[model samples]
Target: MLGFMDYVQKCFYRASKWDEDNSYANLNATARALLDFPTPKGLKMNLSSLSSPNFATSYSMASLGVVDGSVSYLYSSRPLDNALNSGDVQLKDAVSGYRDLREIMKPDDPRDWEIWKGGVRVDRRDTLLYGRMYLPASTLEALYLRRLAPTRQLKISAVSNSRLPNGGTILALLQQDNGKWSTEYLYSTDVALIGMRGLYNFGFDPRKALPRSTTATTTALDPRKIAGRFSAGAEVYYGILNKSGGMSTGFRYTTLPSNVGSPLTVTLTVNPLMGHFQASYAVKAGEGAVFCSRYDFNIYSYESDLVLGCELWRRKQGDDTAAAADASAAAASGMSAGNIDQTWQPETTSFSREGARDDVTGVLKARITQNYNIGLLWEGRYKQLLFSLGSNIDLKRREQPFRTVGIEIQYNS
Candidate 1:
C-alpha cells in the first residue's frame, strides 16, 4: 500500500500548498512534517525552515490590571451606630471574580510563535529579544476614571455624560526573533508599546455634526484637517524602557523634576529569593515642597503552587487629585461633617485637606496553591467594552465596597 501511494503521487504532481494552507489553516504543512507527517519507514531529514528578518527587532513590556475587582471588610473603622450596625462590608466574592478573570497572556502563539520559529532559522544573534506592550490605553482611561478614584461613589447623573467609562489597554511588545536558543538574556527590554483603550464621555449624538472644514464629505486625498471629529489630548508615548529588574535596588535618585507638571511615574517589581512583589509610585507638587507618594507592597511565595502572601500600602504625601471618591457610605463616615463625633473632634472647625499621608492601610489575599488568594485594592480603574468603570472596588474607611462592572470585549492581534 505504501509503494502504491508513492506511485499515485508521481502520476499527479501538484504545487505544495504550504503557503495557502498556512494562511487559512490553523496548522501548516511544515508543522505537520515536523510533528505528525508520516515518514517512509524510519527515514529522517534534519532540514530546518527559512526565517524572516522582520522579527529582528528586540524588546517587550506589558502591564496587568483588574478588569473589575474590589476589597473591603464587613468591619468598619468607625461604623455609624445609627445606620446598619455591621462594622464591615463583604468583598470576598468580588475578589474571587477578578482573581478568576486575571489573564496571563502568553506570547500570542499563532503569530508570535511563528515569528519565534522564523527567527530561529536565521544565524544571527544567538538570542532573540522579545518584549510586550503595557496596557497604557487602558491605563490612561483608567487613570482618568481614577481621577474620580472610586467612580461608583461619584454623582455622575448630574455631571452630564454619555458613555460609561471602562478599562483600556496600551501594551508594548519585544520578543526575541529567536528562542531559548540565544544567550543575550532571558527577555528583551525595548518593547513596541501600543494602547488599545480610551474613555468615551456621556455624550453620544450618533448623528454626524457635519464637517466644518476642508471638504463636504469628499473621499479624495486632498490636504485637509477636516477628516472627522477630533478628540484632544492622547499623547503618544511608545518607547523602549530599560531592563529594570534583578540588579535594580531601592529608589536611587536619578534627578529632581524641573518642570511644574507631574513627576515621572516609576514602577518596580521585585523577585527576591522569597517572592514576587510590585510597587507603583508617582510624584506631584502640592501646596508646599511636599512630594506626594503612594507605595504598595505585596510578597507572595514565588512558587506557582503553594503561594501565600500579605500586602502593605503606604501613601505618604501623595497627590489627591486623582483619588476617586469612596462610596457615599464610606465618605459619609470619615469626611462628612454630619458624621463628626465631638469626642474625636479636630483641633480646628475649619480644616482643609492640603495633602495625603502615609498610613498603615493594608489588605492581604493569598492562595497556598493556584486555587485562591484574597487582597483588598483601595481604589483602581477598570474597563468594560466601550464603558470603563473606575474604582471597581473602592475600599475605603467608612464606606461599604461596591463592585464596579463594565464590559470590554478583548482582541489580541
Candidate 2:
C-alpha cells in the first residue's frame, strides 16, 4: 500500500518553492493539482526524480513533401527564453547525437511547441461547431481587389466543424494565415490569461488540489463567477500582439452562467512537425504571477504606408494569419508598402511535439506526434489579403479535431 500510495503521490506531485526554479516544474502546477492526493498528516512523499524530460521523434524520414526529423529534447520551462526547452544545456547536449534534431523541433511552428503551447481546451457534451468571421481592414497602406475601396476586409473562423468525436481531445492550432517572421501564436490570447483561462479552458477541478482528495471530477468551478467551458459562450477578444512578447486581452460572458457539469477537461493537442499545420490552445494561469499565451491567424494588406489586417485573437482563446501577396505589387505607387516586416515565421519545415497529460486520473499519459503540412495558397481573389491558405496537421492518437482551407485578398504599397 505504501508503494502504491507513493506512486500515486509521485504521479500527482506538486513542486515546492525550491523546485520552482525549473520551468517544467513551474507550469506543471495544473498537472500536479489534477493529480494531488492526500497522505498522513505531517508526512511528505520523497519521490525518485521522474526527470526523463519527455523525448519525441518521428518514425518516418524526410520525404518529398513531408519534412522528417526527431525531437529528443525535453523542455522544462514556464517563462519563454531565447530558444526555449531544448535551449537548456542538458536537453541540447542530449539531442546533439541526433544531428537533425533542430530540424524537427521548432517553437514558432503553428503545431510545434518547444516547451509548451498556451493551455488546454474543453469538450462539448454534444457536437460543438464554432464558426467565426475575422476581418482586418486598414486603409492606411493596405491593398486588395477593393483597392478601389481599399478599406475592406473580413474573415471567419471555425472549431470542430466536422467530427464523430469520443476521445481524449488535445486542441492545438487549427488554422493560420502568415507572418513571414515572428514567434507568437496563430491567435494571441495573452490579454487575459489569468482567471478566465484558469476557470474555463482547463475547467475548475478543485478535487486534485484538495489535500485529501485523489479524484479531479468531483471539484467545481467558482459557483458565482459562471466559469468552466460548459458555462461560457463566445464574444470577442482583443489586444496588441507582436514579437518580443506583447499583451492581448478580452472577455466572454456565457449563455448559462452557472451549472454543475464536469469541471475537468484537458485537450492533449500534438504539434505537427511540418511547421505549417496550425493548432489553438486555451490559456490557464500558473500558481504564481499569471502569464498568458494567445493563438491567432491574420489576413491584412499593406498599401503605401497604410497597413490593414483582419485578425482573430482569443486573449485566452486564440487569432487569424492571412497576409496579402499583392501587398508588394504597388511598391512604386502611393498604395505601395514601404517597409512592413514579417518576423514571426518559423525557421524550418519539420518538428515533433509530445507531452504527458493526466485528466481526472483515469487518463494520465503522453500525447506523442510527428506531423507535416504543405502551404495552402489561393492567390486569385479568394476573399481579400491575396489568398494563400494553409494548415498544420497533427498526427497523434485518436483525435484529428481540425481542418482549414480559406480564401484571401490583399492590397500592398
Candidate 3:
C-alpha cells in the first residue's frame, strides 16, 4: 500500500499534499477510498494550483462519459512529475531506484521518488509508457502495448421497433502479460453476455483450468429512458482471483429536475460497493444560489461509516442560477451548447459558500461459511481535510478492540 501511495505522488509530482510526511499512515488506511469509483451519473471539474521552491503548476480537469457507452480521458502534466531535477543526487550502484532492500520497504524514508505516466487507448488496443525512480533504493517502471482481438465472435443487434433483445459472444486469445503478478493472463472467452445486459468474462492461465481468474458483471439498463423522471438500473459483479473473491450488486437511479424550480438533478446509488450506498442531490435554490447534499450508508454500522456532505455555491449574479439551469438542461437534451456562456458554468464561476462532510462508518460483518463469520471502519472529512479511525472487533469473545487513527490534509492547489 505504501509503495502504491508513493507511486501516485511521484506520478502527480506531489501536486497536492498527498505525499506529506504525516499523511502516510492515513493514506495507507483509506487507500480504497482514495481510489474512488466513477459516479453513476454527472460531470465534475477539479482545479489545483501550487507554487513553492520545489514545485509549481496549475492543473485543471474535467471528466465526462459513462462506463460502457463512452470514452474517458485525462490531460495534465502528471507525466512529467517523476523526472529528476538538476540538483538531485544520482545515487551510484542503485537497483530499481533503491539503494538497498531496506529502502524498498521503508514507507517513511526521505527518498526522492520518480514517476511518469502516459497512455492512450483505441477500441480494444492500448499503449502505455511510464517511468519511475525511487532514489537511492530502486528505479522501476514499464512500457506496455496490448490489444484484444476476438478470434471468433457473433452479435445480434436489437431490432428497431421490436421487442427483440441484443447479445454477442467472443473467443479471444489474450496476451496482456506486462510481467506483473496481475495482468498476466493468457486467454479469455465469453461464457455468456446475452440480452445486451448480462455479462461474463472467463479468463485462463496457460497452466490452470478450474479457472484461476474470472469476472462477471451484469447491468440491466432502465426499461424506460425519460427526462424529469426516475430512470433506474442494477449492476452485479462476481469476481475471483485464485481462491479468494467477492460478490456485490447495486442499483442506481437518476432524476433530472423537470421544471425551473424543481431540484437541479439527483442520483441515488445503492450498494455502489461493499455494504455502501450513496445519494447526491444538487439544486438551484435561489436566483444566485445552489445547494447540494450527499449522503452515504453502510449496512454494517454507521456511527463511523456514514458520510454526509453538503456544498453551497454562491453565484456572482442573480441570473447565474437560471443560466446554470438552462445550460444543464441543454447539455442533458443533446441540444447545441453554443448558447451557454462559459462564464455561467457553476463549477467554474460560483464562489464556494460552504463545503463540509460528516462521516462515521463501521461494519459488523456476519461470517457464515459452511461453518461460521465478522468487521469496523471510521472516516471523516471536512472540506479538503480528512481523518480516519479504524478498529477490529471480535464479538465472540470479550476482548479489547484494536484501534488506530490517522489524519490527512489535501489542498487542490
Candidate 4:
C-alpha cells in the first residue's frame, strides 16, 4: 500500500509541473523594474538583523522624523537541517555552500536577476508572516502568505492608519500556477472590489510527453533556439460599493537569455474602458548596462508621454574569479565561513543582480521624460553599509532646476 501511494505521488507531481508558470501580475515586471526604480527623497537610514534562521527584524528612520520597524518570521515545511539544527561554523559553511551552488545552477533567465546581491531565501511552499508599525502616525501594515499546495497559494495584506479613511484597507489573494499558465483572484476592502487575472504562455509545455526524435529532443532541451515566449493575459475588476467595473488586457514577448548576448522583453497593455494604451520595451545592452523605454497614450484625450531610462553596473576588476578563490583561502586559513556572508551585503534601496557574482561596486540609474524632467540615482556600498544618493531636476524650471535631492543608508546583519 505504501509503495502504491508513493507511485501515485510521483505521477501527480509529473502531471502538475507547477514550476514553469509565472504569476499573472508579473506580466510587465521587467519593464516596470527598469522604468520605475525608486529614488529616495530626504535622509533615511535602515538597519536589519537576522536573529535566527526563521526570524528577522528591521528598523528605519526618515528625515521627517518618522520611525518605523518591522518583524518577519518564516516557516518552511522542510527546513534546511543544517541551518535549523545547529549553530556550528561547519554547518553554517555547508549551508552557505549549498545555497551558492543552488544559485550557480539556477536557470539563466533574464527576468530573475534583480539589482541586489543577497538576502534571505524563502523557498516555494513556505509560509511567511510580517508586520510593521510606524510611529507618530501610528500606521500598521501586515502581510501573510501561505502555500497550501505545490500549485496554490494564499496571501493577505493589510494596512491601518489613523489618517486613512475607514482606518485603511485590506487585501486577500488566491493564486494558482500550472506549468503553462497562471491565475489569480483577489479581493480588496477598498470599495469592496473583487478582481480576477490570468496569464497563458504560448510556448513549450513541460507537462507534455517528450518526443522520441533526437533533433526534437535537442531543440526542446535548448530554450535559446526558440524565438521567444509570448504571453497574453487580462484582468477584470468590479467594485460592489462603487458600482463600477473595469478591465484591461496585456501581452508580452520575451526572448530567452543567452550567453552570446542579453535578452529583450516587450509588453503592451490596453484598457478598453478608458481608451488607454501603454507599451514598454526593455533590453540588456550588455553585461553591465540596461536600457528601457515606455510610452503611455489615451485615445480620447489625445495625450501621450514618453519616458526613457538606463541602469549601469560598476564591477570590481577580477573580483568575479577571485571571490571564490579568496573564500576558499579564507576557509583554509581558519577564518569563519560565516564572515564570508558579510562580504555580499544586500542592497535595500535598489534591485540587485541575482547570481554568484558579487563584485558590483556601484550602480548608476538615470531616467528622463518627454517633459524634460530628469532623475539620477547612484547606489553603492560604503564599508559595511549600503548607501544611495539621488537627485531630480526639471529643465523647464530654469529658476529651480533642482527639484529634489536625497540620500539613504542601510545596514544588515
Candidate 5:
C-alpha cells in the first residue's frame, strides 16, 4: 500500500499538466515576441562554444560604421539550465524511469518522482551565472539566478559603464511561485527603485484534491483540454531618489496547446498614474504563421497608436509535413489539431522528442506602426550558422525610404 504522502503526491502529479512558468512581467510575452522582434542596426556576429555540460563562453562583435565587441561567459549548476546547448541526451535516461509510471497509471492517475525528474517540490536546486564585458567602452554586465527553494528564487543583475550616472546599476529580485500564483519583489540601485508585482491564476488550484466529475477531469488531467486560463496581476513601484510612485494593473487570458499547435494570448494593462492604457492580442493565424496586434492610448494626452505584425515559419519537408498540413486545414475549419487523440506526455519529454524534426528552416517577420514605419526581418540557418537580415523603412519619407539595414550572424558549438 502507498503511504499517505505518496498517495497525495501521486494525486497531485496526475491532475497537473506541465506548463511554462512565467511571471507577471511576461503577461504579454507572446504578443511582444510577435510585434517587437528586434532587428540589427548593423553587422553583428556571435560565436559560442560549450566547454562542458555546465559551462559555456561566447564572443560577439558588431559594426555600425564603427566596430565594437564583447565576450560573455556562463555557468550553470544543472545542464538543463544551460541554453547554449540543449541537454536532451543527458535527460533521456533520467526520464526513461518515469515511462513505466506513465504506462501503469490512468490519464487522471497521479504519480510522484524526484523533483528534478518531474515531481512537485517546494524547493529546487539550480544556479546560473552569466557575465559579459564590452571592449573600448569597457562596460561590464553580470546576471545571477538561483532557485533558493521550490517556491522561491533570487535574481540579481548589475551593469558597469563609465557613461552611467553612478558608473553602474544593480538590480535584485526575489521571486515566489506556488503553482497558482507568482510574486516578485525587486530593488534597483538606479533611482533607488523598489517594486512588487504579483499574479493570481483563476479556476485552478493544484494543492487541492482533484475533482472526480468527468467535466472537471477533462480540465484537471491536461492543460490543453481546458477552455483557457485567466490571470490578474498588478505592479507597484516607487523611486526613492525621484520621490515618485506609480501602479499598473493587468489582465491576461491564454490557452495551453500541444506541441503541434500554437497557443493564443490576450492582455490588457492600465497605468492609472500615467493615464495610459494598452491592449495586445496574439494568435496562430495558421500553420507556421502567427498574427499579433497592439493598441496604446493615453487619456491625458488624448493620443493613441496601433501596430500590427505577423510571423511566418518555413520548415523542411518531412514525414510529419503532411500531418502539419492537415493540422493547418483543421485550424482553417475552426478545429484544433491538438484535440486529436494523443498520449499525454510531460512538456520536457515532448520538447526533447520533437526537437529535431521541428527545426525551422527560415522565418519572416514584418510589422507596421501607426507612424508609417515598417520593419522587415528574415532569419535562417546556413550550415552551422544562424543569421538574420533586416531593414526598417519609413513610408512617409520620400527622400530616404530606408531608415536602417543590418545583418546578424551567430554560431554555437
Candidate 6:
C-alpha cells in the first residue's frame, strides 16, 4: 500500500507501464488510506497506515460493529452509503446473482447509519475544523437516521487533477435510512466544478428486500410490487473554470424478479452537453452451478466501453465452512475472526474500450487458514503485460523488464 507510487515510478522509468507518469496512480497513492476505512467496523487508527503527513500526523479513528442475530449495526469513521454499499457487511440478498451495496441493513432494521467520527487534519500549515452529528429522526420524511445536516465545515483544500494553491471546497450529503432518497452538495473555491445531486428511490419493495418473501403462500403475491423498478435523480452543475454550467438528469431501471434472474439494469443520463446510456446485467448460471457472469456497457462518442467478467468459485462452500470454523475458534479464544480466512477463489475480467483497446485479467487466490492468502493476478493490455505474485504476508510484487513492489498488510478486528 505504501509503495504504490514507488511501483508506478519504477514502471514508468522502465517504460513498462506507460510513457507518462500516471496522474491517477499518484493521486491514488496520495489518498488511498484517507479515502476509505474498514467496513463493518474494522478500524485503521495508525498514522503509519496512511503515509500522508496531512492525515497521519495527529488524527484518531475507530470502528465498532454490533451484530445481534440478523440485526447488525456498524458505527465507523465513514459514510453510511459507503458502509452499506461497498463495505464488508452484506445485508441484501442476491438479485440475479449480484450483491450490491445499494441495499441497507437487515430488513428488520432497515435504516442506513452514518456517524461523523471527527478527525484533525493539517492543511497548508493550517488546522481546519469539521465534523457531523447524526439526526435520528427527520420531520422532512418518515425516515430513520435522516437529515444529518446540522453539520458544519471549514475551508478545506480539494484534491483535483488541477491544483489550486489558494482554493478550497466544502461538501454536504443527505440520505434516508431505508435507501429511499439521497443528495449531495458541493462547492469549490478554487474554480473547480460545483454541483448538487438529488435522488429518489421509487419502487423498491420492502417484502423483496428481505431475505425471504413474506407472502403467505407461494401463489400469493402483491400486484403492485416490482423489484426496485426504477430510480430517478437530477444534477445541477456549474464550472467555475468554464464559466458555464448546465443541468443534467439520469435514471436507472431494473427488471428481474427481486429474487433471481439475469437482472438487467439500464441507465440513461442526459445533460445540456451530452447524453449517454449504460446497460449492465448479472446472473447466476443455475442452482449448484459455480459460474456467474456480469457485464457492463457505456456508450459515448458513438463508441462504447464494455466490461465482461465471470467468476468460477468451485470451493465457495468450502471457504464458507472454513470461515465459519475460524469464527467459532476465534470466539472460543476470545479473539476476533476479523481478517481470518482460508478459501480459494478464481476469477477473470476482460475489458474493451472504444473497440480499440482490450485488457484481460485473470486472478487465482488461495486463503491459508489463520488469515493468510496467496494470489496471482495476470493482466495483458494490448501487447503490454504484467504479472503479480504475492502472499498474505508479502502482498504483491509487480514484475516486468523492470519492477515495483507494494506491501499491504490488512488488519481485521
The estimated TM-scores of all candidates read 0.16, 0.17, 0.28, 0.74, 0.79, 0.39
For each candidate, the alpha-carbon lDDT, in order, equals 0.21, 0.20, 0.26, 0.62, 0.67, 0.30
Native-to-model Cα distance after best TM-score fit, residue 6 in candidate 3, in Å: 17
Indicate which candidate wins on TM-score. Answer: 5
Ordering by TM-score: 5, 4, 6, 3, 2, 1
Task: Quote model 4's TM-score.
Answer: 0.74
lDDT of 2 by residue, 208-287 (tens): 22233434432332322334332111112233433233222222211121223422222222112212211122222211
Model 6 error, position 282 (Å)? 3.5
Q: Which whole-number lDDT from 0 to 100 does residue 137 have in model 3?
A: 25
Task: Please provide, for model 3 over 1-413, each residue's C-alpha lDDT reduced to its tens digit, 9 standing for 90 to 100.
Answer: 11222233333423321212111111111112211211111222222232332233322222333212211122233332432221121111100110000000112212223223454432232222222322222322222222222111121111121122223222222222111111111121232321111111112111222222333311111111123332233333332223322333322222322233444545455553466765655444443233344456777676223222222222224555566676697577643333322322222211122221111111111111111111222222334422222333344444543222222222232
For residues 1-413, what per-residue lDDT tens digits would candidate 1 score against the true structure? Answer: 01111211111111100111111111112212111212111111111111222121111122224222111111111111211100121121111111111000111233322223555742221111222222332221111100011011111001111232222233222212111010111121224232221112111122223243545443132112112211111112223453222221222111111223433333233435335543433232332211212233445643332322222223324433335343244456764433433312231211112221212122222112123222222221122101112223334523655333322211111
Candidate number with the higher lDDT (1 or 4)? 4
Model 1 CA lDDT for position 28 = 19
lDDT of 4 by residue, 1-413 (tens): 01111122222222322232265677776666566666777888776554554555667777744544333333333222222111111111111000010001122232332334367544344565667777656788887766566567688999998777798999999987764778899999999999999988775664554454669676664433555678899999999999999999999877652333566778899999999999998887755777889999999999999999887878889875687686588557634433422432321101122333446677787889999999888877666666778889899999999988888776655
lDDT of 1: 0.21
Give candidate 2's error at residue 22 in angstroms.
21
Q: In each prediction, how many residue pairs overlap at the backbone (N, C-alpha, C within less than 3 A)?
A: 68, 91, 20, 7, 5, 1
- Candidate 3 lDDT at 395 equals 40
Error of 5 at 100 (Å): 28
At residue 262, give the lDDT of candidate 6: 52
Q: What's the ranking of the predictions by lDDT, best on top?
A: 5, 4, 6, 3, 1, 2
Indicate whether candidate 3 or candidate 5 has the larger TM-score.
5
